[model samples]
Every structure is written in structure tokens, then in C-alpha cells.
Target chain A: MAPYETDDSTRAEDADDLRAGPRRSARYVVPVAVVGVAAATIGLVPALADSGNPDLPKITAQQLIEKIAKSDVQQMSGTVKITTDLGLPNLGGLQNSMASAAPRGGSGSSADPSSKLMELASGTHTVRVATDGQDRQKLSLVESAAEYSLIHDGKDVWGYDSASDQVFHSTAAQDGGKRHDPAPATPKDFADQALKAAGDTTSVTVGGTAQVAGRDAYKLVVKPKQSGSTVGAVTIAVDAKTGMPLKFTLTPASGGAAVVDAGFTKISYARPAASTFRFTPPKGAKVTEEKDGAHGDHRHPKGAGPSSHGLLPGMPGEKGAKGGRKVIGKGWNSIAVLDTGSKGGTPSASGAKGLGGMLGSLGDPVSGKFGKGTVFSTRLINALMMNDGKIYVGAVTKDALVKAADTGH
Target chain B: MSRADPETEGTARTARPAADTGPVTEPAGAGRAPSPLRTLGLLRSELSTTFRRWRTLALLAVLAAVPVLVGIAVRIQTGDGQQSGRGGGGGPAFLTQVTHNGLFLVFTALAATLPFFLPLAVGVVAGDAVAGEANAGTLRYLLVAPAGRTRLLVVKYATTTAFCLVATLVVALSALAVGALLFPLGDLMTISGTRITFADGLGRALLIALAVAVSLTGLAALGLFVSTLTNSGVAAMATTVGLLITVQITDQLPQLHAIQPYLFPHYWLSFADLMRDPVYWDDLVKNLQLQALYAAVFGSAAWARFTTKDVTA
Candidate 1:
């Protein structure tokens, strides 16, 4: 005890006396109680907050799917953020190969899209989009203040990049006025992709309501029945009032966090002004005119399933696009398998052996019901390269892919 | 003063009073000690004493200057119309847009400092809380005052917490000023991909700053416990900062993923979730709860050690 603590000396004696008895134990009761309550609440809050959706009316999976399929809310404009987290090493050589494989000299694809070869090319990008009906639309990818935008009015399409000071122009033949078909695929057409043929491989369920893009949304969860797939589940948040899809998340089958998340942070149903679709090339900008077939439309045959190509479409004679690719299964669990040897040539100087060795070394080799394959995964997309030349790719789990390979052939 | 009050200890003392024990001039009450008002006075003095030190002032000055330096450097890098390269570095990607909307500077500065500088500053202050006083031989006089050990410990912690708020606010305010000076302030896009009004954006920035401060609570308590372990302020500060860096490195190791969630800095970056539209609350809620868990565990440990600690310099 300090000499100056004259007053505390006496109290210290009392504390000592209390310390020898139940009074000392009493000091701990309050703190212990508080900790207990806190621990209990911590354990309970997330679970409680996760379970209920008071605003959403109960509906069967079939009815909800029907509602989603029939939703016709068009002429909406909003900003969307796309994040892809594929857990793969940064391979500069792979990026170079992918970039050189594109036809238009790597002009207006995406930022280092050569790098986008692996969904493991993890990044978050912002796209601002406006669509009036479908034929007239404009979408811009904003990087800082610079914008890479694509504008299509009727058959004329222009892609402008402010940073590169370049514009790409192409024209598509107009559809016969008498024909009746679904609108041309707009830039923000994820809802259509998510709801497409979901009944095949997915077991649909209604989840709790959430507020997305400042609107009330009901969750529509599509869970894959196949066990081998890496995709745990696909969740879509549909606007309760307008029936428009506002958010889509794909959680990997072996979940840690969402692999791919695409959603509107803000949205408005009101049609964008007519001027939003117009673009005038700035002075001194370089202009490139591309042939009609260069716009990727030639790859999607009429009545054919969605193109099985990666985000960056393969150009003519490009080894990637030349590979014979086939889809196995259907819906969210579907796997796209490609015979990479079909190009009848080895990859750049790296050679098929080097590329194969590199990819194999980068990915984990797993032998399962589907035999041996090397799996490269991120949060969203998983690529399984078999010992043979066949490559299986999907958002499904590893086992699901193996099963698909076993049954797919 | 008579010793009839049950609250006063009944122990006997044999040592004589030490000299130069300033601030003990207040006369002892009859059978009572200092009033609540005087205890509050102790808190005020504690805060002033902590904040007024040259080291503390230097820490705050560095924190305040970080935003200005960042803002100026970004302004120069982007230069009027040149498309800024993708927001470089590990900070939130939106930091690149600071040139377009200065308001983002607040977020940028926070993100820039949270990983090392800010936490380092916090570790320094918290590490010195008790050990510094004891090192300077003032702790004996403080404990000798009517302020009991438990009460004084609480005051020391409260003062450190108050420093947390001041330090965060200084960074934010400096960034706000520098942002307004260097770039346009208007509706800004959020991480959720939605546009929010400038006013609302500012409000969110404030919330983010608060969250950033709160994120350090667990570390603050941890440092308090370390401070109680030694009489040398330097050792306490070093150990606290060593723990922080080690945990940060360990959190990144893939093999340690199972234990990373329990780390204090694991969710420190969760403040980015606030910038999203509809305001993602799950990680934010988890962060607060984790901080609470840390506070409870380490705070109790600090109390248990500090209460019975011998004050000898």
C-alpha cells in the first residue's frame, strides 16, 4: 500500500476481509452475468435475423417460378456491381494467351479481359445500364471517371471507351417487323439467365425477405440436387412490388463466402430519357468499323442453347472458340465440357504440355467417382481439367462435376 | 476525519506519506472520501493529461495529416481529366473515384490507415495507459488518492476510448476538408451500385468512421491488459503492436482460416459493407459482437490483474 493512500488503507482492510468471504465472490457476479447475456445474444441474433420475412407472402416453388418466368418489367435502368472471386494463382502467361486469342486485337473487350480467362480473376466492376424496351439500350462500365460504354439503337451498335479514345462500330440486320420473338439480349439480362430452365437440376424454395436496391425483395433459392457440383445454391432476390429480379448470388457448394455476386445497389423503373441511348464520338477519337458477324451474334445459333463460351467470346479461328464444346446436364448445375485438342494445334510456345503442366500444377488433383481431374476453383466458378483433353466447367461442387462427367459422356 | 463509514477500509498503515504528491490538497471529508464531482474531475484531468502529451499530440497530428497527404497525392495523380488508373492498392476500389467526388477521401483515408498506422497509434496510447504512469512514478500518488484502484483503472480505459473517437474524427474531418477542396462533392455511387445524395453520403461516411473506431475496441482492451503486465511503457507498447501485426499476418494464412475469425482485425475491413446499398448489416453486426467478446474477455483479465497489482516504483 502507498503511504499517501491513507484513506484507502482502511478500505483495503475491508476489501481484504470481503475477499476472504463471499463478498469477494460477489464482485464477479455482475461481470459474469453481463458476459453470459452477451454470449447468448451473440449466438442468437444472426440466426434470428436470418429466418423471417414478414412482408413476403407464402407461395409454392412452382407458382414462384412461373411468376419469375412471366415477369415483364422492362425499361428499367440501374447500376450493377459484378464481383468474381475464383481462387486461382495470377498466371501472366495464361492472360497473354487469352488476350492474343481474341480476334479484334484485344480492342474493346474488358479491362485486361485477357486476365478474365479464369473466374479466379477476382475483381469488382461497376456497370451503369439503361434499356428502353430492348432494341435500344446503353451500358457503361465506369472505372473512376473514365467510361467504357456500348450503345445500340435499332441495328446500329457503337462501343466507346473514353480511356482508350476508341469507338467500335457495327451494324446488325434488322429483324423482320412481322416476326415475334423475345427481345434481344440486353446487357443486364442476368434475371433471364438465372431463371432459365431452373426446374431441371434445382429444387426451388422460398427464403426470407430482404431489402435490395431499396426495394422489398423475396428470396428465391435454387439448390442443386447433384452432390458432385461445387455450387452450393443460387439465390435470387425478386422485387416484391414489380416482380423484377434485383440481386443474384451464387454460393459455392463448399461455402465460405459468395463466389459471384451481381446486384443493383440502386434502381429505378422509370424509363431513361431518349438521349441516354445516343452517343457521339469525341473529336480525335480513333474509330474502328467491324463486320456485322463480329458482334458475337453469329455464335448463338437460333433455337440453340445459350453460348457455352466464357465472358470473353472467342474470335474466328481462335483456339478457344474452335474447341468443340458441349453442355452436360441442364440449368444451374449444367457443366460445359470442351475438347481443347480440337484446334489441332498446341497452345502458344508454352505448348500444350507446358500449359497443361502449369494448369495442373496450379489446380488440385482429385480422384473421385469421375476419375482423376485437376480442379481450379474460386468462390463462383470451378474448372475441372481432366487427365484427358476434356475440360469441365461450372459453378457446381467438385463431386457434382465428377458425377456430371461420369454420366455426361 | 473519523473512520466510521463502512465503505472505507479498516486496514492500518505503517509507511509515512511521500512528498510532492500534488492534487491531494482537497481536504478529506468526515468519514467519507472525494465526492462524485471530484471523481469526474479526475476523469477530466486524466483526459487532459493523456491528450496533452507531446507523443499523443504527435500521434493525432499524424492521423490528421494523413488525409491531407492522401488527398493531395491523389489529386496530383489523377490531375483534372486523365482517367485515374483503377483504384490501386488494397483499399476499397472506390478510392480511385476520390478525384471525382472528394467525399470518398474520408473512406479512402480510413481504409489506408486502418491496416497499420491508426491501429499502431491506438496500440501506443493504450499500451501506455497504466504502465506509462507507473514508469513515471505518478501511479503511486494516483492510487493513494481516494480514487480506488478499480475506479482509476476505469478512468484510464475511458480516457483511451475517448482518444479513439477523437483520433477517428480528426482523420474524417481532415479528409472532408481536403476532399471539399480538391474534388467535387455531390451524389456519389455506393458499393451497392446505387447513387446516394451528398447529404446521405456524408451521413454514411460518419457512420463508417464510427464503425472504424468501434472496430478497434477489442484491441484497446487487449492493450490495456498488456499495459497491466509490465511497469515499462516501451515493453507494453511493443508487445501490443507485436500482437496486432502477428494476428494480422496470421489471419491471411490459409491454414489458419479456422482461427482467423476470432482475431480482432479479421472483420476490421467490414466497414466497407456499410457503403453498400440497402446497407449490409450481417458483417457489421458480427464485427460489433466480436469486439464485445474481446472487450469482455480482456477487460476482465485487465481488471483481475490490475486490481491486485502492487504499485511500487
Candidate 2:
């Protein structure tokens, strides 16, 4: 100990050096910390500003709804990104089924039925949507160089996929008669659909303000009141200035990410370029003319989820033809029960026969509040096969489908 | 010879005529080697050492050849000019449009290479930078050149960075040349569904190239730090590339998504935003910011290790 001990002078000098080491290193540490913090702050600015919007005017749910209902915003264009995460295995077959079941030659499902159906089946997708008059609008899914576009110009609707070099044209029949025009399945249209169905089924409340598409928006949350449905809530971001619904997100009662997160990433009130509404198939493109009747009659009720088939007159099984769909419930949580079975409609018309016994013979039987039923679930669509032979399906949860089955008749 | 050495050593020892005369003045020449490094001299030396190697040349050649092969394949596929939209195929979806407008070839080439090839090249260059010199026993001499450890490391990093810019530009330029030779170059349609004049498109292409080059800065710094860890250049190169692929694979996994944003390659595709009509800058800005974060963290780590490291190799 005596040999190891340094003299008082030397010991003090060593102590000084030890203290100075950290003090000197503090110079670098301080700048690094400051720069790191600065970089992080800059990186987080967008998210923070997005999450903490201060200037938005607070309003009640009713006032927001009234504002949305009365607001008029036509001929607007923006980039909309849609993401669907249905907790299902493979979405490929489901996408095909949805694409087939979806109204043809429309933007209801996506701009490109085949491609966008596959693209949005799992992950995120960006599409450009623009609407001019009641009779004119365009939805273009932008690919790298190739684009798929569906343009409705007054008298004619066109579906053009540049990648596949195919064009689908459908002409509206001009009967000297007034007819109800099915609104394009845009975010606004979807929001309006949900809002219309918010009667006894949902509890509407005003949520905190959020910044959506660089605009101040008041959040309107609509939660289904009845536990009969598996719907957790439907959140719509109503633009404060324009009163237009800028974003619509639906989360199932069986929670995960939002099932449908369709929103405008960028939006503008200015009129879209007129040329966007017009489409002439490029030279050498294969053209196919589709009869208007195939998709003309079906109107996707506003809140009918992503797939609405109220217009399909006959059930698939009932007529031995491919077209038939039964929609249960109303509003943003409606489920369309489609019978994709090769045979015409289900064997039992009335659901009096316990579906559990019949569906047990078909699909894998899964039991819940809806009683015994064969359950087939996808990330985006859930189907409950009842013994009554009705396959209840929608973007809602299993419970919602069960409730629909109980009340669908 | 011994008497001759002393005679010459006497002049070398007397050269300074200072209190500290060396015993072996002829060979020590410690005072003679402390020449102040000029910035241009440092850059020239770095460029020569890096580019003169066969490995570096091979990487560049491979990079340049990619666009050429892509251009030829595109030309062959669409010779009749009746091709439909791009299909699920090799290269980017933009490659399908090269027949219509050759200028898209540049974009196609960039998209094709950015995922792996470009980053791999950058990793190789940066990984070999400091470690290779150390392995070759040239690091001690380089440090002795009065450049200081910090300055020498800076030069090495700067050289690797220059290679990044060059590698990206090479792919772009070769695509441009092949594109111009094969297809007509004119006004281009942007991904955001907007039309841009040929001149403006060229400007955007250049910016995209710059963005892509800057995107690799994080990887460059990471590889540089890895290089500082060992004396084996090959080992460093392999480790850096392996880490690059691992980070990339991790980024793709949905389970590890919470940490994906911090990964180096997370924002590589943000350059596509530049091709949009109004240009979406959110992800692009984040990409730049993230890269800067990586550079700062890893660059500081490299400096700390390098300054304290004993040059045993």
C-alpha cells in the first residue's frame, strides 16, 4: 500500500486528469447529443405536427355531421392511399373473389380490378382520384410507367389497363328516364354511406382533432352500440375548412390494425385537369365491350363496406346464374352475403333450419354467439357459413356477420 | 559502406543541427517525412488507390453493364412496339415503358440496381477503405503523412463517398446513353400522373441519381466503421455486406417493423417520390435525416475506435 501510494502532488495531478478526461469528452458528447436530438426532432416534426393539431375548431358530432351533409365539394383531385390488413392467410383468392363480386367497370373496389385488387389485398396502395360533375370522374392507379384507369365521362365508362394493354368500355343506356346515379366509391362516398346508417345502430361522438392531408380535420367516431356486431368503430376525419371527409378508417371489434384505412394523402379543391376525365384507348390496345347490365343495376349503398351488391337482382344459386348477392344490415357496417357455391342459392330459403347442422357438413365449424357455423375468414372479408346455407360475408368481424345472420331474414 | 553511411548520416544529422540529433539520421529521417498534406494531393492519392484496384474497376464495370443489358433486353422484348403494359418481370415495371421512351431506361436501371447492386458496390468500397490499407501495412504510413488520423479517415470516407456518386452516375449515364441510342428521348410522363418536358425530366433524373447516391451515405459510414474493426479487408467487406443484407431482410419482416424505420435501407425507395408530379418530400426528407443519423452515430464510433487503435498491423 505504501509503495503503491503516490505523493500528494502527483495524486492530485492524477485526479485532475481523471476529472478532465470526462470534462474534455463532454465537449464531443454535448454536440453529439444536441445534433442527435436536433435530427430526431426534425425527423419527428411531421408526425408530431400531424398528431398535435392545435388550431382546429372543436365541434360536436352532430354539428360535424351537419357540416359534412350540407358541404358541397365537387371536381376535386388528390392522391389516396388505401391499406387493408385482414388477419387472413393468403389474400390472392379473396381478392379474386372480391374483384369478381365487385361491380365491374367502376372505382368501388379499386381503379384496376385485377391489379389493384391484388395490390391492395395485403399492403398499401396509392391511387389518384378526381371527380368533375355528377357524370364525370376518374380513378387511376399509378404504377411505375403503366397505369390502370377507370374514367366515367357522361355517357360512357372506360376501364383501361396499360400494363395488360386491355380496355373495357361500358356505355350508359339513354332511356328518356330519370335514374338514381350510384356514387363512385370514393372516401367521401364511403364516409357518407357510414354516416347515413348511423341511426340506432351506432353511437356517434366527436373525437379530438387530427391533421389529415395537411388540413385540419375533426375526428368523428361512430361505434356500433350493439354487441351483436363485431364492428369496433368507424372513424371519419372531417375537413374543418371544407367539411369534406378526408379520411375514413374502420377497425373491427376483434382488434388489429384498421381493416380499411382509406384516406387522402394529398388533396386539392381546385378542379382537376379536364383531360383527366377523358380517355381514348391507346392504339393497339385490346378492346372489350362489356354490357352495362352486368354492373349497371347494382348500387353500392354508401356504407356497404368495400363490397356492395344491393343491385344484383338474383342470388347466384337461386337462378343457376353467376349473379346474386344478399346484403344484411345498413350503413358503414353492412355485410353482403354472397353464395359462390356452384349450385344455385342455398338449399334452405328460410334460416329456420339450424345452420350449424348444415354448415357443419361444409366448412370447418367454429362456434360463437351466432351458434354453430362454418367460419372462413380473410384479412379483409369474413364469411360465416350457416347451416341454412347462407354464407354471411363482409369487411366486418365474425360477430357482425353472426348478428347479420340473426337479423338478415 | 559503413564509413560511407556515417558520412552521409553526418549531413542528415547536421541538417537540423538541433539538440536532438538522431543516431541513425540517414534512415530515421523523421523530420523529413512531416510534409503538410494538401487537400488536392490527399484526394488524388485516395482516388488513385481506390480506382486503380482491379476489384474497384470490376465493380464499376459490372454496374455500367447492367443498364446496357437491361436496355438490350427491353429493346428485344418490345421490338414490335405492340407490347402491353409492363408485366411482373425482371427489372422495374418502368422497364416495360423503355420501348416507348428510352429515357425511362435511366429510371428503370436505377430502380433495378438500387435494391442490391448499388448498395453492394458502396458496401464493398467503404468496407475495404480503412481496413484494406491497414491490411496492406500502408495505414501507418498514411497516418504519418501529417494528415492526422482524423484527416486520413476523412479522406478515405470522402473517397468512398465519391465512389457512391460515381457508381450511381455510371448506371444512370449508361442507361441514358443506351436509352438515347435505342429509343427516342422526349417528354416523359411522371409516376404521379403528370407530364414533364424532356429537359425537366432529365433534371429530375439527375436529382434522383443524387438522391440515390446520398441514400447510401448511411451504409458507407456503417461499412467504414466495420472496416475500422479489423485488419482483414476481406473479412470487413463480407461483414459489411452481410449486415446490409441482414438489415434489408429485417426491414422486410413484418414482425420487426417497430425498428424498421431506423434501418439504413428503410427509405431507399423514397427516391421514387422524386418522380411524382409535385414530389412527395416526407419520406425523402426522412430518408435524408435517417442517413444523417446513421452517419453521425457510426462516424463518431469510427473516429473513437480509429483514434485510439494501436496500429499493430
Error of 1 at A350 (Å): 13
For residues A230-330, write the lDDT of model 1, one tens digit per residue: 66777888887777778877677677877567788768889877766665554333456764343343332221111123321211112223334566655
How high is the TM-score of chain B in model 1?
0.89
Model 2 deviation from native, Cα RMSD in Å: 9.5
Which candidate has the top score in DockQ?
A: 2
Top-scoring candidate (TM-score) = 2
In terms of lDDT, the poorest run of 10 residues in model 2 chain A is A311-320
Report chain A TM-scores, every model: 0.68, 0.68
Quality class of the docking in candidate 1, CAPRI style: incorrect
Query: What would the per-residue lDDT of candidate 2 be over residues A340-361, giving only the tens digit for each residue?
Result: 3444333222221232343344
- TM-scores for all predictions: 0.63, 0.75
Q: lDDT winner among the candidates?
A: 2
